[model samples]
Structures are given as C-alpha cells and as structure tokens.
Target: MAVVLLLVSPASQALDKARMDAAVKAHLALFSTDDIVEERFAQRASAVDLDGDGVEEILFMATARCVGANFDCPNELVVLAATAGAPGQAGKRLEPDVLAAAQTGYGLAGSEQIPGEVQAVRVLKGTIEIAFLAQQDSPVCKRSFSTDQGRQATTHCPAPGRHTWTYRWSRGKLTKVSS
Candidate 1:
C-alpha cells in the first residue's frame, strides 16, 4: 500500500473539541466498516498547523487487525486538511499528501518477526518528528544439538532499531528535513 503521513508543530492548537469531533466523525464515515468505530480513532486525533497557514490540519493514526501473532497492529498515520467550500459553507475534508511512509508495526519476515512500531510523533521547533522502531536483520545463531547427533538449528533474534523521520512545510510543500 502507498502510505503517507504529514504533520507539524509540537505546540498543537487547542482546537474546538466539538468541531474536531464532528470532523473526525465525518472523516470516519468515508470508510464503511461495521468493525471500525469513530471513538476508536477519535481519541488519537489532534490539530496542528502543518503548513503554518492559520488553518490547522487534523492528524490521526488509523489502525486495523493485528499483523503478527503477537497482536502487533499496523497503523496508518493520516493527515486531513480543511478545504474551504462556498462562502458560509462548511469546509470539505481534504487529505493532504504526506511526506513519508515510515514503517509502524511488526510483521513476519520468513519465520522471524520484523520489529516495527511508531514510538512517538511530536512537533519540535517548526518540524514534525515521527520516532519509530524499524525492521533490521539480527545475527543468526547456530546451535548444535548434541542430543540430535550434531544436528544444528539456526535462529534469529532481532532488536528493533530506532529511527526518526523529520519533516517541515516550506513553499506550500512538505519537505523531508531528515530521516
């Protein structure tokens, strides 16, 4: 899947909770799924001025069923921009193109669980920081089974590596400051 996310500012705006709630409900309505509920994603929503434009953007993480036996759920970080409609009319929901598709959950990779998860997402200075644990290969261990007459078993134990994707808005476009 082509996944992307956008964000800005550590100092999030104190948006109208009622308005944000309504926006979240409206946004969730786009997906017709009996299994998904508004409250499930609402609590994770926030408002940030990603472009420094007076208007704020909605940031939320969408999650689904577990991706691994350990119940590691996958998350899609979504950013919704408010679009102005006819004068005096409510703005339309516009999902702005995001900067990166950083991994945010664990998955099975050839019998080994690849470590991945979003540790934290925060705005620092004028940029957004998405801290996560990404997948990386571990050293394979070869064990000799004495009871099995020299039979050997290979095992892999990987430690998730920490990573951060930093982004900022410049010239009406989202730019990757670092990763």
Candidate 2:
C-alpha cells in the first residue's frame, strides 16, 4: 500500500494598522454598516515621501461591493491619507460645504455619474485630500440637497452601473463627496 501527504500554506498578509484604519474610515464614510447583508471589500496602500520630513505618507485605495435594492451597483474607490503615528486620527473629515464646492466644481449633481471607489488619500500642508472615481462612463450627473440650517448638504449621483458612494465630514457634519 502507498500513501501520499500534502502540505498547504496560509496566505501572506501585511501588518499596517494605520493604513487599515484609513481604509475602514473611508468605507464607513461611503457605506453605512447599519444595513443587513454585509458586502465584500478590500483596501491597499502605498507609502511615499511627499514631504522632506523623512517620514512616509500613505496613499490608499479601497474597493467594495455596492449596497442597492437590486444589487446592480458598481464598486467604489477611495483615496485618502493618514499620519505615521496613528492612522485616520490625524485626518479630518471633509465638511458638507467643502464637498459641495468640490462637487459643484466637478459639475456632478442630480444623478451624475461618480466613481464607486476611493482611489487615494493624501495629507498636504496639514490638510487632507481625497480622490475618487465615478461609476458611469458617459456624462455623469451630480446633485446636492440642503437642509434648513444650511449647515449640512447631501450630494447624490444616479449612475446605474456603479453601486458605491463616498462621504466626507468636517466641522461635525457629513456630506456625500462622491458616488
């Protein structure tokens, strides 16, 4: 009689807590975990010396499944940055007005096509910048809604292909930055 033996190896993983937290914050900003039926997602980061401080800044990308009624939305991309000591703790969320300004500049409102994921985030001159892509390839539609207080603004995109969106908070208000 003859016997055979096989060995398996576990997948390799990176140990970067700061990068992970930035990705998670981005995810929470985009998609609320309050809903049922969890979605699959992934995030990665690349370190670069943006400044001459000899410290490496992180540029991260996050992708996740969209939460929709029919499950027909596209993936999301988010780009963000965090300091070296503690991840995400140093970065400030974007304000609704700031997001509105950016969206207005991009001409994305009232059912525009926006990127589904956050592709990158960076810190520059003590400020945080976030970059993202839209879902629709054609003319994208973007819109914004305002409340009575004028302190909060909600942005929306109506891209049929993509299923994810992004949010930014600043000064204690949350606004939809991209979708």
Q: Which has the greatest lDDT?
A: 1
Task: List clashing residue pairs in candidate 1.
Answer: 10-123
TM-score of each candidate structure, all chains considered together = 0.49, 0.30
Model 1: per-residue Cα lDDT over 110-132, one tens digit each? 11112346578787555767676
Error of 2 at 89 (Å): 12
Q: How much is 115 displaced in model 2, in angstroms?
A: 1.6
* Per-residue C-alpha lDDT of model 2 across residues 13-110, encoded as one tens digit per residue: 23256644544444434544435324535455554433434333333443334333223233333333232232222366666544432322111111
What local lDDT score does residue 155 receive in model 2, on the 0 to 100 scale?
A: 44
lDDT scores of the candidates, listed in order: 0.47, 0.38
| Model 1 stretches with alpha carbons more than 4 Å out | 1-14, 32-43, 66-74, 86-115, 135-159, 170-175
Count of clashes, each model: 1, 38
- Please report the TM-score between candidate 1 and the true structure: 0.49
